[model samples]
Target: MMALRLRAQHRGFHSRRPSRARDVARVGRVNPPAIRVVAIAAACILGLTAATFPADEVHWTITGQNSVTVDWRGGDAEVRYGTTQALDRRVEAVAPEPLPFSSRGPFREAKITGLDQNTLYYYSIGGGPLHTFRTPPPRGGSGFTFYVQGDIGGSLDWKHVAECQALIAEGRPDFVLCVGDLTYGNSVGQHAVDTHFNDVMRWSLDAAYMPAWGNHEWDKPRSDDLRNYKGRFDLPNPQSSPADRRYPYTGGGEDWYWFDYGNVRFVAYPDPWSGAWADWAQRAEEVMAEAEDDTAITFIVTFGHRPAFSSGEHEGEPELQGFLGTLRARNPKLVLNLNGHSHDYERTYPQGGVVHVTAGTGGSNLEEESGSGCPWRGGCPEPPWSAFRAMHHVAVRLHVENDRIEGTVYCGPAGGGGSNTNDIACAQGSVIDSFTIYPYGLKPGAPKPPSEEEEEAQAKKPAPGR
Candidate 1:
């Protein structure tokens, strides 16, 4: 694996910001041209090169209970797992499947499934040192935690992203809900996409990252990034959108996927522009509606690149509005709806017993809360539906317990650069917002584990599709 290069954190030099008033004044006095020249040199130094890729760049994903999907860049990849760090067992190397429309290598996936539940497993990829992940206790068991964020990318705000990722590493969530836009200015080609994946590779140490497709993942003209997303990620996407070809500006392939982890049912929807809206909405409705009757699922968490409800400059989407309407119509007690694209943090009131949250401020330049329809700032009054909104960057931490899921939005510093996870994740300091989903219909009753026949049938049954 290539060395983890954290921008602005090189070892030879100490990087510091103007912390004092006089220092800030001195920084203000610096010429813009000098800054641009230094920035250009730094960018050129970090420019994407095939040499920067790990000989065996690897990452992991959670497909289902006791199941994980390991994807690597280099071919002829192998994985080893056992109860201990010294892996005594090995899964033979397997060839990757080629993309449907490209020549940029193949999607190498090795699935480690059918393991014991409520147990920790140690594993390694491509002869790397062993890493660890725990099979979540069967749905509704205690001690469950997860982080949610989106619009996270590399190259632009490397220091900020690194700090947030470090915070998540410390929390050690079972899995990460990466709503969408996992890459940005760094997403130039397939290799760049993989490099972007490797940027957050540290989070995969203890948590399986489950990501969705965002608009930025679609590179127009050639659409190589779309091919890269399909070729790089092996999610449990039983649903397919054939009408993806109808969208002229986007690329397509199994962007919508879902999985059950712990007591939560997670669904990842695609960017609306990529395919048929009607088809996508119907699929979303089915997923949410079906959860209403699922007693074992104590919480429902759905995410995507764009938010169905937001208060940022984007102000949310009508497509999501209709989808939420459908979900409300079905009366499923959804715990949280996670989304990105607004570049800020926002939470909606418990309208019809569902809370909608937007945590798009992951490393991207913060978008001021100018268009959330607030009448003022600092202590503004949001509309009846919007509970909280902020322009600062934040990542949402959800602590799922028996009857309630408490959430804390860890706000980052004034500007991008950050030093420690403590500042990025705490009840004080940068932490600004918090919310809770009480024992709504979803979490009230004691969980009854889904029957074996039902789980088996659903696994074999295809998700509703167009």
Candidate 2:
């Protein structure tokens, strides 16, 4: 039955939308009264088609401290934004070209600039309905809030996905960050990715989605899977030498780039592939080392797919350990490292001064302990720098205020049932763990110069020592 469903989903990729007008006309000739009814229905359909699409899954993200990017699932990607909710007062805007309708889907995106820092603005897309978003202050005076999750592969049976969606709806975060494994394209097809987007569209109707690559993203080959991934989303690549070209290849590939929103500096790292793990690790180290100490960057957060320490059946990879070691060396307020792969939730303390969180329980099948002798598995005797661990389905809610960053893990019921239980196999809601991250070089009143202890702590430790 599951295989049949997978086949039908793959078949959908080859399907196309039919002409509604012809179908309506064909049905109208059956009877005069029916024709009259058909005419009315056709008129209504025409009106709906003309009034601009509903702009499904409307979301916003911080393009910069003073700029916000509004994106939606599909439709005329245009924004009619203003300082007032009336929308009568038009402001700066941009409209993407009409997207071609086909199974080879495309995700539309547009960035709105010239926004007032720390001010509230009302905006609407295609003259539809007005929505509101608050811009971050120019200097990062106060804090902000956002959402993060992983492995939500559009499973229709997982109740936890709906629960997490409801949590996001209530939280009303500034943006959403997905670590990896958003859609399980392995063993399935491209339709799995589409289904995942469809499910996400239902829940994330007002949140901007920031993503990192996962293993599932590379389940196929670069030619097949990479095309699907690149075609669907529009991410930032500021250092691209040739504009308008796809996949702006940087030192760490085009997908890897750095951007700043308010006081936080986010670095999106691509998953290591094709024996390039060591190269990726070295590049991450270089990027962190080049970041400024006081300006443009305050906090550094890195996200990828596989984890450095996991107790799942896959266990931890040695290449990831090398990458983590290099990343720890360039200590630029290394706040958090987010990942998804274990099909469960876990959070670790400041390992070598960096926090780690695994949020792989996003609507995927949970993997039980294989009881294998993998070093990171079988439960660490002393929790190997791990602050918290759980095998339940969950996601993380981040609240960034001023110079402090706080994160809370929202656990939901595990398994296919709806019952809420605390058992690792049963999904439930609870705060598994929480942590706060302070900006670099600023720790309240002291104002002292960089001490030797600080330098040694922040600097990369020798490879042998590590």
Candidate 3:
């Protein structure tokens, strides 16, 4: 098989950082919502080739107010950075870190500390081109935009993933959530590892990313597991890993973890394919119990690779159903749930007021809402819970704020101009689904199920208009 020497052509990098509220301290604590989103669209674009040498394989991760991790291809070099475009200060250069077993090349990492939140900074590795990333706002900031994506970086999905990456860069979210399935072809091998990183180098370097394991990452010892997943990214709250469970079974992220970005608290569960649902459930219960008094937490959100509720062809996950059901029992007013794996875009009606969203359209082939039936223990159907389902390659965008949180599902067309610039880049396709969440006085628990007699009485009652 002939390898494709990848490259994208574009001018100097562009960044539209999130505007921090003047009173960041006061804004983030509002008892209302998380992130505010204006609109959603998925305009597909291809032909993303633009960049010079040295900068080609550079990217940053684990970015917070006072810390950041930069990974670049070079012999051995320290990082130099500062607030201005010209990097005047420099961190002592260090030897290149060992690459994942299957990966090849002299890639190194530099951990830079002492940064201010909501401030824009520029840095370069070993005197390379100046790259930029904005750290998330302090604990309580009005809220900012973040992107959630999954099921990308495969042979067939390569171009689409690259395009999606381009689109992501265009948005310049404060941070991003990678919902697993980083790469498909030999996820841990040299070819797959290199391809995956290079594909996103265009945009990933501009935004901080938090990665979750997917079925493609597999279940193995933490050191050698998930191939480059662990090797690539880190989270702000790494110690909150729920999978540790006194035993700390490090197979694909301790099976679960949680972190607070700005005012939102994000809880991620283990991949259903990893066979770690038991751990995830335990963790979910623990967090919910804590949520009752955790005033620091403005929003309680959950994420994972498989969906307990989906209207696609891929089989459903009973574990997810059990996992989320636990949250419902514990925290009925759960704000949101993000998921992927069933390559399609799906939004479920608020089940007792929590939105469960499936966003597997991150460059994978779209699964049609066909009659193929989902193969879960009970089976999958367009349950009354399904609000919308579409077969379009797309990405999920969320805007967080103090009082109200909004979400938009953007679907790209089956075909469009093959370029990642101009209208194609900002192409806001029609919004297929959108939802809002309120944090203040959210019901503590699910409403008691109506009795059969009460249900009959309600049914006998006249309609709203009547």
Best-matching candidate per lDDT: 1
Query: What's the TM-score of each model vs. the native?
Result: 0.74, 0.72, 0.71
Per-model lDDT:
0.60, 0.55, 0.57
Clashes of each: 0, 11, 19
Q: How would you encode candidate 1's per-residue C-alpha lDDT over 1-466 as one tens digit per residue? A: 3211111111000011111121111111112257756864675698743333443445677666677667765444567776666767667544444342332333456777887766777776655555676665776565577888886765323445656666666666777888776765223333335445656776765577778776666534344445556655677755666444534324344668887766677777766653445566777777766776777776777787776676554556666677665665454556577888766678888756668888776554554423434412333556678887766666688888756788887766455232111212333235688877865534446453343345677799878992
| Residue range 1-466, candidate 3, lDDT tens digits | 0001111211110011211121011111112122211111111133222211243355666545577776655333666677775677777534342244434344556777888766667776556566676665667555588788877654333446666676676666666787876665433334554566777765666766677776556533442344355555545545333342322234534345676667776778776432356655776676765664466556678887777777664545655676676566556436688887766667787665567787776664444422333422223445677886665666678888776677876656352332211112224455656777666325335354443345678999999997
On a 0 to 1 TM-score scale, where does candidate 3 land against the true structure? 0.71
Model 1 Cα RMSD, Å? 11.1
In candidate 1 the C-alpha lDDT for residue 100 amounts to 25
Off by over 4 Å in 3: 1-57, 63-65, 92-98, 154-157, 187-190, 219-225, 239-255, 273-275, 288-291, 369-381, 415-428, 440-466
Report the C-alpha displacement of residue 461, candidate 2, in angstroms.
20
Residue 307 of model 3: what lDDT?
73
